[model samples]
Target: MPVNWRLKLKGFGPFDTQLDWSMSAGSAKVAIYAGNGQGKSTISRLFRLVENPQIPFPSSLITTGSAKGKFSFTVGNGSADLGHVEVDSSTGVDNQLDYLFHVFNSDYVRDNLQSRSYSPSGDIEGYIVGKSNIDLSNERQSLEDVKRKGIDARSALSKELEESKQELVSLGASRVKEFQEINVDFLMNKTVKEDCYADKIEQLKAVDELPDDAQAPDKLHLDDSYLDLDQLASLLERPYSKANFAEAFLEKVRRDAEFIEAGMRIQDGDRCPFCGRRYDEESRLLISQYDSYLKDQEATVIAALKGKQAQLSRLIDDYGRLEAQMLRGSSSYGEMRRGFDDLAKVEFPVLATTADFTTVVNAVIDEIATKNEDITLCVSSEAVGRLRDALGTCQSQLRDANKLIDELAFNLGKSKSRKTTLRKDACAELGKRIRREHREAFEEIASLRSKYRLLEEELKNKEAQSKRSKKDAVARLMANLLKGVFGNRYTFSEADFSICFKGETLGKSADSVLSDGEKAALAFCFYVASTWELINEEEDKNKLFFVIDDPISSMDFNYVYSIMQVIKNLQDTFELSRTRVLLLTHNVAFFNMVMGTKTLNEAWMLDEGKVTEVKNELLAPYAAHLRAINQVANGAAPSHTTGNSIRQILETLMHFEDPSLGTLGDYLESDYGGRLNEVAYLHLICNDQSHGTRTFGYAQPPMDDSTIRRACNAVIEHIRDRYPGQLVTAGVEPSENNSSS
Candidate 1:
């Protein structure tokens, strides 16, 4: 059972800010002193809200520019762990403190007692029990089925949502990591990767035309044409035929190829260079052979063909080196594949292989040797055309290589753009993959959410139908409310839920005849009676708590004491090991009475958003009022109630001499008063400002606090000079050398 409570109130009524304005109550008799306009009623509403949170927010509590109007209430046996009752403008209300809170204020009276045409719905404390007598077991079973289905659907929907979220999360992370691994500077981090992808996607629209040449970045010469076969064909077309040439000599020359080559250089003129004989046949044969060798057209053609062969060999070597340079490493190849393969979606063309290129080169070399060996052999047009055909194959291969290099250059030229495009391509691939892989989970979550909503609606309809027979709480509540009362002063007729005043059923007539004090007292009895209902139902009475806010409003001295006695009787009747009462009032006499003997000495003051517990002081209300005025005389700040205190003090003194002298102007006209001319208008401003709900300070274009303080101070001093002895009766001790003369 919860035995104690504490509340934090702010941004409502007099609090006017989002501050943790706190108070500890209910373990003992907590008395808080707050004058009118100091948020007394707002604090009461905080407790009332706990008993019933469904009540519409009272618009009157909101200030013009205050914090998000919110309330938080808690209950415990003075421990760090506590249960909470929360309400805010946003969440409406969640009353977790249970029904431990009860309040008595003008609202309680107006809601319960004054509005005599009460029905079962208006019973805030219907604290109702006992269900319908009629049997609707089938309808209840149907509602139970919906409740179960709702629970299961909600659980399944939650699971599906979690799974879908995980799938997306895994996909996003995998894509982010893959883009980072592409080893590009722009895709260094996750945010950069995503932003680069999205930005380039937009940028890619501007560059809608594809890369200028779509081929591999590595350029390799793969055709025999790149071997410069045109020059080889031209060398093959040369003539080296001689009709008088000797066959045997030619055979010898062929056999002695090295000797003939040397003889040709030595035989510079006519003399037989080898044997030193002139015009001899043998020497001439040697000289003629040398001369024939030097002028041999076939030999000259062989020399040109050999030169072309060397040039082709060197060209082939350059092509091989270039092929090796472009397609060098696995890392570079993989990067290229990732960028172009995924984005272009076109199959990458394979370049002509090294073995194929080597085969073609060897064939062209053999053909060159054939032409060189038989220089006088007329080159066949068929042979030239075949060579040209092979060269054409080589030309096609070279075209492929150049196209690949051009394509590679085009993409690499915009590598920043390429990187962006690559990132975008990677992102897009993931989108398709995600849609393909997790489509079921996404669809299932959405389907379950709709099913859950429908089940909840079904449950509501079933519940309403199941409650076809409900027992009215009115008769039971009226019986309980009439248990404890102030004699036959007022009896509530249960039929119409109206108060029977002396055999006449008072409808709205309760307001016509009864004074505010009588109504307050009558409302308090009903409030007490509701607690009797609580005491009967509750096994542990200590769990119940009551907050009485200004219960003795406008009550005379006799009814004030009667109200106090009634509250004490309630405490005795509670029969708990301990009883807690938090009596908050702006009424001075009631505060003094509740605080008990002057030696009791424990009192709390709430002023200007702060609370102070002043112990070990005489708890006299009028004396405190006078002391506040005296403190202002000695340069202390005045309180909001300073004007009310001044008015009371003056009213008490002026009426002491003449009961009819209600105002300062009336007092001034009397014989014992000062001249009537000066300061008469102070009556209009000072007298009416401290009074009631339309307290002039709150109603009119308000005077600042200081302006009201000065006015109240002036009146206190003016009266204190003439009636110092009367001030003593209220409790300002006379000074030894006081200037009362």
Candidate 2:
């Protein structure tokens, strides 16, 4: 069990002065007596705050004149401080103090019974138990793994497909079908070697054919009939001289007289235009000789020879020009030029000016013509053969190159188509597999999630069932405690699953039917019973400390005795040596009763803003009220304070027995039969004399002390005659000689 060995309070609540409470080892119980609002409940609430650090600290806990407060305590046998609560600018406590103590006070009673009708749905203890045991880690982890694996597998497959598609694009497949259909055999096989055929095709295209006009002429025929053959022979046979040609021409013209005269006129006559001089016999004779010579056939032949020689020179010049203009690379033109050069190197017969020279020149011309004809025939025939051979070679090479290119293009087309087809097929297969795997993974995840959800539902159902069972058990215990406290005057039952008194549930009609004392008794019984159930179910009973505050409030003397017995039974049930119990109350009579039993390890009285240990002494407000009453009856001055004490004593008695007479005025007027001045009683006691807010002035003309003393005596005599068994004196037991009416 967790026990507070030492507790210190500084600037906290009504305890403005520092206070220390140290519990000795093996001490099981401590009883603290304090009047209303004297910090008895504050101590109980502080223990609760220590047990649950998450609860907000009470603002009222700060001392009246201080801004900050602190509470410190050491738990169990260890001297180390287990927790501390500080209230200053902010309020906080150590979280390590959770679940160490349990407290039952008026708040517990109100929450369980009086605040609302008690019902099974409102049973909080079972809910606490259910929430503590819920586990779903393994199922969630399995679902996550399934999802992760599926995602990873799909991602890997998609990456592979994307890479394969990129590879196909690099291979020059423009469309899907092109790369999809490609196979290894199609790639390896080549219709034509690219290095061998591609260049050959280009070379064949570069070889161009020559035009028809560029070819050599088919025939060589010379028109030498226009040539001066005799002159040509003469020039070839004789030494070439312009002067000898003129002398020969003159000798030929001397035979004709007319020609002679013409010649004489050319030599000596100035009178004639044709001849330069007059015609003499010698000149006539010379003319006659030239005339005869002119008539000769040899002269005419010489003229013809000269003409043939001029024609031959012109032909040679024309042939030289033709050769210069011929295309250089033409095979036909080349052959023709070579033939012409060979013909020019051959020699021909020389022509003479004699009559026979004509025939000789004619024969030379004929020979030259024949040789030219032969050269023409040979060049034309050879050129035809060479040109034909070249054309054939060019056409054959072009045809072969074109055939190789066509084969290569066909093979390339097939390769692309095959690759496209293969790519499409492979991608389709991969996509199908990926989809199938994704579906399978999705189905698996769905199945796992379904099972996980069902398990969650099962857990919720079991928790609800457990809560119902625990609530039923608590209800039975509460009903039994209620019966024990109320006796046979009331019967308990469950109506709408709520606690009912005498067949009526609380807050329905029980309030009107039962008195305030009965209601307080019911609340007390319920709190004690619930606490008993909780402590019995606790795993570590030693760690629990029970702090009960004012359990007997609004309860009659009969219930007070019963409640004390219940507390004693509880202490005995759970060995007090193991569990620590702190009971705080403002009821002096009850406090004295418990103190007289000698069952408590220690007892302390809270009065005049201080807590001090007390033994065998009555504590105020009970002691104070009793002493003041005795003093007044013994001739002491009856002041306003004494008047208030007289009223307080009467109020306490009326509340304890006849709770309907809740105030001193109500008891005085109703039970005393108007004999007591109720107005004077209120004026002397209940009026706010310190603040002076009455309709009259602050000095209300002090009532005659004798009159107040007489009133006090009348009330005391009424108590002694009506209920003499009740104790009214401090430090004195009730008289057994007095009897109830």
Candidate 3:
């Protein structure tokens, strides 16, 4: 499916220059027609290059100095195209698939894993002993069991680790808070007591209301002097009233005279310092008059004494109000004393409720918290180790399980291999027996092949009488072939071509009795049948590709005509539409013959290590020769038909149905026309002219440079014109032979 007939190389093989070649796709088949030494076989090797790129060029394929080539092809459906692949003289990798893959896929059996010699015995025994297939359905149950246990362990470990961590964190935070509380508790009473005492001092100073002569009380707003007098008056109550009043009155009068003197000093026509404005003359006069009146009034002191008496009553009232204000201190005395006492006190009595406080409780809480923290640290540090240990234990258990599984798997594998080996060994033993039997079969086949070859050789060697015997041998081989076709037991009369099986020949046919078609079919069947037989015992499943190279090479034209049918039948029988077939030949006649009858498109033609175009009839030389014969027969001259060249006669003889020699005569009538026909006919000769045919003057050295050049040009130009881009480049040089114009 990956091959297409239309695929071809541009410049490849013996066609040293570029050439666009085409062929068939699917059932179209492929054909290639080219002069000898033009790299036809080189093209065949191209497939080998594609499937494999590095096929060594045989010395024979090299035309002149150059072997470098380029190949191109359409891989599948013509859409998936693999473009040109070039091979210069030096272009090749050491490890090439074309050469190495086959070496790797060779018949030698090797160990797949180690790539070394291996025997199935050990593996077979292991499989039988393990009995791995006994209860495959129960594997799910086993897996479930394993899974359940794994889950259990995982859950337990997860919960244990998670809770342990949380407990430790909580304990750590509690410990931090406890330490803070203890420190604060220790300082709380002292701080509170200090503050309480400081407050008490303030309260005591408030009650005392210390006089102004003393240092001012921190908490009092009174002036120091006023406070001092007020305190002295309080202390000097009752009998000390006169002195108190004298001191109080004297201080008051002194303060009043100072105030008056400060106010009396006034400048005439100047602003009064106290009121911030100029004193008018009238105002100044009024002030002077008042002063004089005051001086005069000083004589009338009795009147002033009466006024002073009234002021004395008001002073006494004020004195009584001050006394009342000082007396208010008596109310706060108790609070001041209590506060002072509290500050001076040594220790406060413990409240009865405090007696229940226990160090044991604190110690218990602390110990619990410490243990929790230790547990957390321990879990964090040791969890992985514990888990590892647990995992190691689990793995140990799993190892045991795996051992059981391995034992079963090994046993099963061994058993499977053993069963296959047994079958293969039996098949091999049978094949050996069969091969021995095949000795006779092969001998018979060889004999028939020899007989046919002798007939062909006789026809080739004794040219004069060869014609009669060749026809006779052809008939004889045909008759003999009927024996194989009919399976042995038959009396050959002109009437009966049928045969029946007899004796050991029931399943086998002696070579003497096989026809050309039967021989070809037999060879085909042997290869294909043997392949199937081999596949029967192939223990390990392996893909195989069967290649039949020129299966009908020894057969006649009639048999050659049937080769395509045989191939088709085999392809269908083997389901080998997928199998690759690489048919190589230079027989255009045979290729055309097959193409005339059957459609085979997957066929590919090789040209100069590249896939190019080739006709189906060319696959068999006999078929191509037949085409040439028909051409000559159809174009032969009736007058000189008997005197014509043997090649022409052969062409005439092959035109079984062309009664009118019309086509052959048209070709044989003229000299240049015959020469042209001959050139065209060369593409049909599949015979390996390694031993040239003298009748065709093949032994003569190839034409001189000019002649060969003229021929090369004609062919090259014709090919190029037909194929447009296709060309055949032949590197020819002057030889010993002289050139004639």
Candidate 4:
């Protein structure tokens, strides 16, 4: 129960200057009156902000050109500071203020009003109370987790089983069913009790035979000794005694051939090519020496050596061709090819060299007495033996290679069976365990889901029961309040836990319906009734504060009176001495009605950035003006705008109490017997001066303030004398300085 005892504002909203409001002791109800735009609504918005402190103070609340402002409220009768907020800086109040104050304004009515259909006895299925049921939520989440885990387990088991079957297929199992039906433990633990075909595999690996396509080394025939080339050179020497003379003449001829070939034709009288001189006796002598040297027997022996070198080159070329063909066919015989290559590389070069062949042939020709003597050359026994030994090595290597290939093929065949057996055993073990665990997990998940569903159903039932009880109570209170406000014009019934209006339910015309005013009235009745119900149910009723702003706005005059009665009833129900209420309005009649009906402990008038305490007792606006005019005539200083004030008072009196009286001028001319012309004249002066314009036919002579004040007094006297009991006067006790008209 935090009550606002005082409020201090600086540069806030429309109040650009500092403003303060204080509630006197024992003041449980206060009435504040302000014309439009006088900070009345600003105060209401501030109260809402204080209740909901999470809302930031509006930037527009700061006065123009002001960077910052602050507001502080004193709470309760002890004047403790409840909150102090700087504009544009802080959120005003906290949630501790909730339910302590309730404000209702035109916006609240518009936001909450709606056409709703209801049935009181219907099940309250969607009602929510306080926080959610945590136990129910936790149960649901736990069930979901179980289901997720079960799905994962099932998927994993299925995957493992499929992979195991695939692995068995890769190991050459013809069909999965053959191994799937076998006992996993027995198959894996059993040893190889049957023959593994080891002896046959070993025999295959050890057997060796050369391939049918294997070739033998070619035969070689070498002579018993190499020929001596130097002996052949002696046999070719000239037998003449003039050998040196012939040798010198050959040397001279050899030098002259170079000069003759350079550019000179070798004619009988040709010039030497190198020196550009005619050939002389020395050049002719050199040419004759070449002719004689060409007839020597040494040329024949040199030609025989060249022919033998050509024969050796042909033998080497034939050997190379044969060796390449042999190696190409040795792909399946590595050892055989290596042996042949080694033998060929070492021995073939000796017979291939041209120089070696030439020396051997020359020596052989020199030893033979005749050129036609058959010279047979045969290979040495040792060289032939080496060739035979290399062929034997190749044949042995072929046998070893054949044995190794057989062994690999045999082992590969046996491994296929062993791998298939292992895969079957693994698939059986893993698949069996996975299926068992997956079944258990799925069963647990199913059981949990079923239990969770039951618990949720029970929780919903309990919530429904609690909601129904609360709704029914509110419906009953609303119906009762509606009866007090509308009487028998409309029937009030509770349906779907809401108040409904009915004219036909009471046997009236089918088309009879509630007007807009009636609807608003009913809505207002519901709101106020529900609020009272809450207040009554509150633990500390005395702590409650109600703020209602312009409750009867846009309401019919009759309904406004009814609203006043309703408020009066509420005051009596909750004693004003104990409960605090703040009523603010721009409606003068409604404000006066409330003030007149209830005992307001304090009153305030707000205008032009200022708040002033009002000492006058509760009175209608017309009566208040009349009282003010009476004061002005009694030597009190006149209000600056007393002219317009008096005019408004007379108009209000005519409109409400005497409708036939018409305008103020008509009322003065008719009801007062034409004796109150000066009062009417004063009214016209007030209207013209207040509006800053001259009304038509209001060009009478001007009167001073004293004369006008006197005329206001005379009009009050005439109203009292003429209509003695028609007007309602201010309720203040009579005093020397204060008087009611």
TM-score of each: 0.45, 0.42, 0.28, 0.40
Report the lDDT tens digits of candidate 3 across residue range 9-88.
43344565565655434542333443233455455555444334444643443445554544543323456543333444
The model with the greater lDDT, 1 or 2, is 1
Top-TM-score structure, candidate number: 1
Q: Please, what are the lDDT tens digits per residue for candidate 4 over residues 1-741?
A: 334566677666776678887665555678887655567777765665654343555777667877666666555544554443333234454334334566666544554454231112223222323224433566666656766765665565445555655544544442555446433223333333333223322222222122334343332223212323333334333222222345555455334534433333344446654566776798777655444444443333333544434443454444455445444433333333222212212211112233433343334434332321211222123322332343344335434433433433343334434344434444454344434434454455456556657766766665444332444545666677667777766545656344445433421221235566665676666556445433322233455667777777668888888877776565565443465667787667777777776645567776556666666634356655665666566655565557776777667656765687756667666644345664546666666757767677447555677877787777666666766443343421244345433
In candidate 4 the C-alpha lDDT for residue 71 amounts to 68
Q: What TM-score does prediction 3 earn?
A: 0.28
Instruction: Give candidate 3 misplaced runs (Cα > 4 Å).
Output: 1-13, 22-38, 46-60, 70-74, 78-551, 577-584, 599-741
How many clashing residue pairs are found in candidate 2?
55
Off by over 4 Å in 1: 1-96, 99-218, 221-240, 243-302, 306-335, 342-376, 379-384, 405-450, 460-741
lDDT agreement with native, every candidate: 0.57, 0.52, 0.35, 0.51
lDDT of 1: 0.57
Query: What would the per-residue lDDT of candidate 1 be over residues 189-246, giving only the tens digit for each residue?
Result: 2131122343334334323333444334455454344445666666666555643567
State the weakest 10-residue window (summed lDDT) of model 2: 200-209
Looking at model 1, which ten-residue stretch has the lowest summed lDDT? 184-193
lDDT of candidate 4 vs native?
0.51
Say what the RMSD of model 4 is: 21.2
Q: After superposition, how far is residue 176 of candidate 1 from its true place, in Å?
A: 6.9
Best by lDDT: 1
